[model samples]
Target: MKTFPTIETERLILRQLRPEDSVDLYNYFSKDEVTEFYDLDSFTELQQAESLIRIFNDRFITQQGIRWGITLKTEDKVIGTCGFHNWSKKHFKAEIGYELSPEYWGIGVMTEVLREVINFGYKELELNRIEAFTYPDNIKSRKLLEKSGLSEEGYLKKYYYVKQRFVDAVIFSIIKEEVTNDERSKN
Candidate 1:
C-alpha cells in the first residue's frame, strides 16, 4: 500500500481523509451553492460523504491519486479537500481539484492550501505539469487558478456531462519550469 503524507500550512492541515469525517463532508457538500458547478449532484445523504471517503482512501492505497482533507489548525472538522487526480506517473503530470465550504469561501484559505499542494506536486510528487478544469462561468475559480500562477490553456465545448447536461469547461495549467521561474524571481 502507498503511504500518504500530511501537509501543514500556517492556518490549515492537509491530511488523509478519514471515514469519521463524513459529517463535516456532508455539511458543505449538501449546500446547493457549493455544489452548483461540481460534477456530481449536491450530496443528500451522509452515506454519500462516507462513500467518498472510502474512494479517497482507496485511491491513495492503490497509488492512483490523492485527496487531502482540509482542516483548520484550530478545528478538527474538515472544511474542504484538494489534491491530485488523473495522475500519470509515466507522464509526470496530474489534474488538481478542490472544493471548500461556503462558510470559508473568499478568505484566502484555499489559496494557502493550493500553494503548498502545488509545491508538493512539483517537489515531492516530481510532477512536470499540473492542470485544472473549471466551468466557464465559474469566474471565481478561474481567477483563483490564475492567481495561483496557472495559465488559461484553452476551452472545451460540452467538455463534461454533469447533472444530466453537457457543460463547457476551461482548462488551466502550470509546468514545473514556470514554478521554478516564479520561485527564482521571488528569491
Candidate 2:
C-alpha cells in the first residue's frame, strides 16, 4: 500500500482529515449550493457530517484511497475536502471529488488542491488514470479541472442518479504520463 503525504500548495495544505474538522465541514456542507453539485447526501446534521468524515478516514487505509482536508494556510481553517475515491485497483483508476465553501469559489484554491492530489495519485499511488465527473451546470469546477491539466474527456447524459434525479455529468481525466514532476512542482 502507498502512503499519503501532507501536500502543500501555494496557499493551501492538503492534509489528512481529522475528527475535529466536523464543525467546519458542517458549516460549508450544510449550504445547499455547495453540496448541490457534489455526490454527498444533504448535510443536515452535525452527526451525519461526523459519520462521513469518519468514513473518509476509514477509506484511506482500508481501500488505499485518499481523502484530504483542504486547509488554508493563512486562516488555519478547513474550508473543504478533496479525494481520489471509488478506486479500482485492477483498473488502476479512481474518481476525483472535491467540495469547498462558497466563499472560496473561483479563487483557484480548488485548482491548487487538485494538482497536489493528482500528483499523489500519479507519483505515489501509481494510478494510471484519474477521472472526475461534474454536473453539466458546474462550469466553475469544470473550468478549474481543465485549467489544472485534466482534459474534458466527454459529456455523459444522465450519468449520475443524485438527489433523486438523473443528473448529467462532464468527465475529465489525467493520464499517468501527464502528471510530470516538473509541471506539478510549479503549481
Candidate 3:
C-alpha cells in the first residue's frame, strides 16, 4: 500500500502513528505494567516514544511491516498499538504484536482491533498465516489470542533473550483457510 491505510471500528480508529502522538504513547509505555510482558523495558523518556514512532513508520515505508496507532473514535490521542511485524511476503506469513494501556485492559478493545487487523492481513497483505508469540505466563494474551480464533501451536524454549535473560514464548497461529471457514460458519 502506497498510502497508509486507516481503519475504524465502533469505538476506535487504527491509524498511522504521527509525531504528535509521542506524548500519548509515552504515557502508557512509561508505565511498568504496560511493558511487563514486552521485550523492551519500560520507556523512561519521551524521545524513546518518538523514536518508536519513527521506526514504525520506517517499517511500513520499507515494506517490512505496518504498525497502527490505536485511538478512540472520540479522541485523537493514541491509547495503544497493534500490527504485524517480522513480515515475510515470500512465506505469506507475519508475526503480530500489540500493547495497550492498563486503563484500557479487559474492555474488548484489542479484540476488536485484532479482528480488523487480521482481516487486513489476509485480504490486503495476502498472508496465508498470522502468528503471535507471548510469554508463557501472559494468560491474558494467550486467552485473547484464542478468542480471536488463533490456536496454540507450542512453546519455544528460550526463544528470545530479553531484559538480559532468555525467555520462553508460547506460539499461537491462524491460517487463511481457518479464517475463511470461520466467517462462513458465522454466516
Candidate 4:
C-alpha cells in the first residue's frame, strides 16, 4: 500500500519491482536451476517477466500481497525476489516466497533478507504469523527456514503443482512471539 514498502539489508536492497527489471528478472527466472521448485516454470520470453512485474504491482494495489526485488547495494540490477504471497490482513498471516540466482547461493544473502522481511511482517505488517512452503526435495530452502527460526509445522501431500505434477511441501512457520524472543536474546 502507498507505493509499496522498501526494505534494506546490509548487502541487499529490497524494493518494489519495476518493469525495467524485466531483463534481470528474466535472467534468473529463465534458469532451470532457479525454477526447479518454483510454482511457475522458467520464463522463455522477456514479456513474461515484464508481465509478472505488472502482476506484482497489481497485487500491491489490490492489497493481496507484495513482492520485492532483491538487488545488491552496489549493483543496480535485480538478482532475485522474495516476498509475502497469499497474505491475509484479517488473519494477520502471510506465506513467504523467495528465490536467488545460483551464483549467490552459498553466501548468506537470503539469510539477511529473510531476517529483515520477517521483521517487517511482524512489526510493520502486524502479522501474527509468517509461513513458508518449500518443496520437500528442496533441502537448501528447508534448511534456510529452519536456520532462520521457523519451525516445521507439517508436511502437505500434493500441496503444490510444480512443473506439472503435484508435489508435496513442507510447511514451516514463525510467530510474532518467536521473533520477539529471538530479538530479545540478541540484545
Score each candidate by Cα lDDT.
Answer: 0.93, 0.85, 0.96, 0.90
Lowest summed lDDT over 10 consecutive residues: which window, candidate 3? Answer: 33-42
Taking the tens digit of each residue's C-alpha lDDT, what string does model 3 give over 1-187? Answer: 9999999999999999999999999999999988889987999999999999999999999999999999999989899999999999999999999999999999999999999999999999999999999999999999999999999999999999999999999999999999999889999
- The digit string of per-residue lDDT tens for model 4 on 83-142 reads 888999999999999998888998999999999998888888889999999988899999
| TM-score, prediction 1 | 0.98
| RMSD vs true structure, all candidates | 0.9, 2.7, 0.6, 1.1
Error of 3 at 159 (Å): 0.7
Candidate 2: segments with Cα more than 4 A from true spot: 1-4, 181-187
Pick by lDDT: 2 or 4, better one? 4
User: Is 1 or 3 the stronger prediction by lDDT?
Assistant: 3
**Candidate rank order under TM-score:** 3, 1, 4, 2
Kindly report which residue stretches of model 1 are placed more than 4 angstroms away from their true locations once superposed.
none
| Candidate with more favorable, higher TM-score: 1 or 4 | 1
Q: Between 3 and 4, whose TM-score is larger?
A: 3
TM per prediction = 0.98, 0.90, 0.99, 0.96
Which residue pairs overlap in candidate 4's backbone?
none
What count of clashes does model 2 give? 0
Score candidate 3 by TM-score against the native. Answer: 0.99
Give lDDT tens digits, candidate 2, residues 42-151.
Answer: 68889978998888988988985789999988876789989988888899999989999999987888888887888788777778999998988988888888887889
Q: What is the C-alpha lDDT profile of model 1 across 62-107, one tens digit per residue?
A: 7778899999999999999999999999999999999999989999
Off by over 4 Å in 4: none
- Name the 10 consecutive residues with the lowest summed lDDT in model 2: 177-186
